[model samples]
Target: MLKVVVTGPLAVGKTTFVSTVSEIKSRHTEERMTQAGALVDQLDGYRADGEAAKTHTTVGTDFGRLTLDERMVLYLFGSPGQQRFRVLWDDLVRGALGVLVLVDTSRLEAAFEVMDMVEAADVPYAVGVNRFPTSPVHSLGSVRAALDLSPGTPLISVDARDRDECLDALIAMTRHVLAPLESV
Candidate 1:
């Protein structure tokens, strides 16, 4: 089994992305933690609307499975974004091939902590910019510069609700992870 971890800041659509591409119904262990309680987790500009009703902040992790081909099965694990849950990252990332770090253009700074953590872990990762209704459209180059990503890093736009787009992102990560093995 190939493990793929989807990590990002709070409310950046990590769960939604996994749910979109997962073949089996994804299991999300999510509970709403009060915004007032966690000063580090900000809910600014988060609208409480129709979709908001179903929104869940991942308490631990979201689990999902996808069969990419006859020979490979991907196990998707989504990490909780709150600072307090940072401890769970090591456990989630162990033995994982790569990570897909979701980002919201409007809240780019929110993604910094998670991105830094992934880099520190020495895990190869690609950035998936989740397109939200209110998210501003920006060039990938600009977003990469803002994120200070290296030229080799892959960055792509995706709709969290679209299954094909989510699958494409996962495939990109797979290719990134496999390139070195193929060269060897």
Candidate 2:
């Protein structure tokens, strides 16, 4: 099975994305948010009511599986988004075929660190702009420019709540990562 890592900033919907696409029950290491914890966590734009909008956060990794065909199955590992959990990134990405870095347009800046970690891991990656209802609708070109993505990098819009959309994004990343080997 091919491994893929799903990473992004806090509350960017990594858990939801995995759950929506997984054929089986996905494993999550989520914990309920506390008032004290919310003060330290970045809760802006997640909800109008702040911490109330986000009741749970991923304390560890999220895991899911999707079988593409008889020959191909993807094992998805979702790394926790908070900076404190950055140490887990190396292990999560060690053997990953590719990575799907979900981004919240409302907080584009938060994505830089995640992207850096992915790049440091030296894995092929695609950027998926997870559009929340309150998120601004930026053009793909503009986002690419903002993220400083290479021309060949795959950048697509994705709805974390939608299974088909998430699947398509995964396919795009897989295709991009595998393209070179296919040529040989």
Candidate 3:
């Protein structure tokens, strides 16, 4: 079994992405946003990404399961997007196979922190761009350049609401994980 961590900034669709692709019943720990909490959690970054205001947010974590085949099963854990909830990251990242960091083009800078965390954890990862209807289109090269991604890292475009799209990203992630082993 492989454990894949789905992480990204607030409102980057981490919860939605996990929900769309998980084969088993998904468990999400979301809480309705209160005005007091909103004051502490700034929306500047997400709004910059052209996301509509979010009413609820994932406070703890989201859990789901995916079976690639009879021999391979992936347990998906989506960490809370908010920085305040990073207390759970240590627990969430244990024995993770890899990470899928979702990025919104409108706020490219927002991905740096998550990428850094993944790197610090020394985990292999793939980047998935969660495409929204209003998201600006950019060439793969430009997007990779903007994110400072290496040639080997997988960067796939997907719609969080679309199951096929999410599945395609998962396929890309699997290939990324296997490429080095296959070469050796």
Candidate 4:
């Protein structure tokens, strides 16, 4: 079995990505937003569910599983987006084979922290640009440059809500994770 992390900034669709790709039902530790959190969270560029504002947030990690073959299975962990929840990252990345960093075009820089966490975890990672309906067009080269990504790092566009796109992203990440093993 392989363990992978699906992580990104708030409302970037980590939950939707896991839900779309997992063969089995996903477990979520979500809670309704309360007035107490008003000062704790930011509401910038929030466009989930087409609601004027997002209400629910993941308090803990979201878990799901996907079967690649009879002998292969992928365990997916989706992370909470807020910086306050960063303490959970180290634990969540344990035994993870790789990380799939989802980037929101509108908020590309928001993914920096997630990428840093992946590096800290000492795992291979690929960046997937999660497309939103309102997202403006950005060239891949610009994205690569903006993120200061090495030329070899995999960067692909994906729709977190689309199964095929998620599958493609997963495939890319798997390849990246295994490349070192294959070369050795």
Candidate 5:
């Protein structure tokens, strides 16, 4: 089985993506949001269902498993997106085969630090643009330019709430991970 890390900035849909694609019962370490966290957690203009804002925050990690075919399986690990949880990223990303970094077009800058950590770990990664109702509709080129991603990196539009869209992003990451081996 390949271990794939699902990561991004706060409220970028890492948890939702994992839950949508995972075949097994997903495990989440989510905590109810309190007013005290409002200072650090930004929910403004971010809607979980296009109607209501998210009420919980991931405190530890979210886990799920997906079987792509008879021979391939993916163990998905979703890291907490808050900045305070960054210390755990190294451990979460350790030994990961690849990473799926979700981004909110409305808050593209929030992704830089997460991408930096993933790059520093030297793991192959793809970016998933999760467009919420309030998010600006930027072209893939614009998103790539804004994120400063390389030409070869996979960047795709993904609706984290949709299974098919999430699976497509995962498949893209899998192909990306296998490309180097295909040449060798």
Candidate 6:
């Protein structure tokens, strides 16, 4: 089994992205961390489903499993985004194959910290721009410039709520992680 961790800044669509692609139901541990800041986290045009209710905070993490094909089974770990919970990153990434760093174009800088953490851990990763319906469209070049990524880094736009888009992002990450071997 391959461990895959999805991480990003608060409300970057990590949970939604996982839910879209996972064959098994994605487990969510989200609870309202702060009632006062509820308005701040809202994604402009995005809202949770009717059945969704804020818990308190994701004290631990969200877990899910996805079967990419007959040969690979992916276990996904969704880590909380707030800096206060950053201490959990090491544990969550312990055996991860690679990470999917989701970013919101409106808050592109929010992904910098997460990217730094993953790079420090020496894990291969790909960046996914989670596009919000209300967000202004930005070219891939502009997004790459904002992230300051290397030319070889994979950067793709994804609708975190769309299954196919999420899968495409994961596939891109997988290819990145295996590129060295694929070229051999």
TM-score of each: 0.93, 0.94, 0.92, 0.94, 0.95, 0.87
Decoy 1 TM-score against native: 0.93
Tens digits of lDDT, candidate 5, 24-65: 989999999899999988777677757887899999999999
* The best candidate in terms of TM-score: 5
Flag clash pairs in model 5: none
What digit string (tens of lDDT, one per residue) describes model 2 on residues 79-164?
89888787787888898999999998888999998888888888999999998887888999999999999999999999998999
- For each candidate in the order shown, give its overall lDDT on alpha carbons: 0.87, 0.89, 0.86, 0.88, 0.92, 0.82
Candidate 2's C-alpha lDDT? 0.89
TM-score of 4: 0.94
RMSD of each: 1.9, 2.0, 2.1, 1.3, 1.2, 3.3
Per-residue alpha-carbon lDDT of candidate 4 for residues 1-184, written as tens digits (9 for 90 to 100) = 9899999888888999999998999999989988898787776757774555688888899999999889999999999998999989888988899899999878887888878877778888999998887777799899999999988889999988889999999999888878889988
Rank order by lDDT, top first?
5, 2, 4, 1, 3, 6
Q: Could you tell me which 10 consecutive residues in candidate 3 have the lowest summed lDDT?
A: 43-52
Report model 5's TM-score to 2 decimal places: 0.95
Which pairs clash in model 2? Answer: none
Q: Mind giving the per-residue lDDT tens digits that candidate 6 earns over 36-97?
A: 75655544443333234444445568888898679989998888877777899999999899
- Output the lDDT of residue 87, model 5: 84
lDDT of 1 by residue, 22-138 (tens): 889999998866656457667775742224533448889999999868998889999987888998999899999999999988889988899989999999899999888877899
Q: Over the stretch 1-184, how does candidate 3's per-residue lDDT look in tens digits?
A: 9999999988888999889888987999999889888776766645423555678889988999988789989999998877889889988999998889998887788889888888898888899998876668887789899989999999998888899998888888878988889988
Best by lDDT: 5
Candidate 5 structure lDDT? 0.92
lDDT of 3: 0.86
Determine which window of 10 residues in candidate 6 has minimal summed lDDT. 42-51
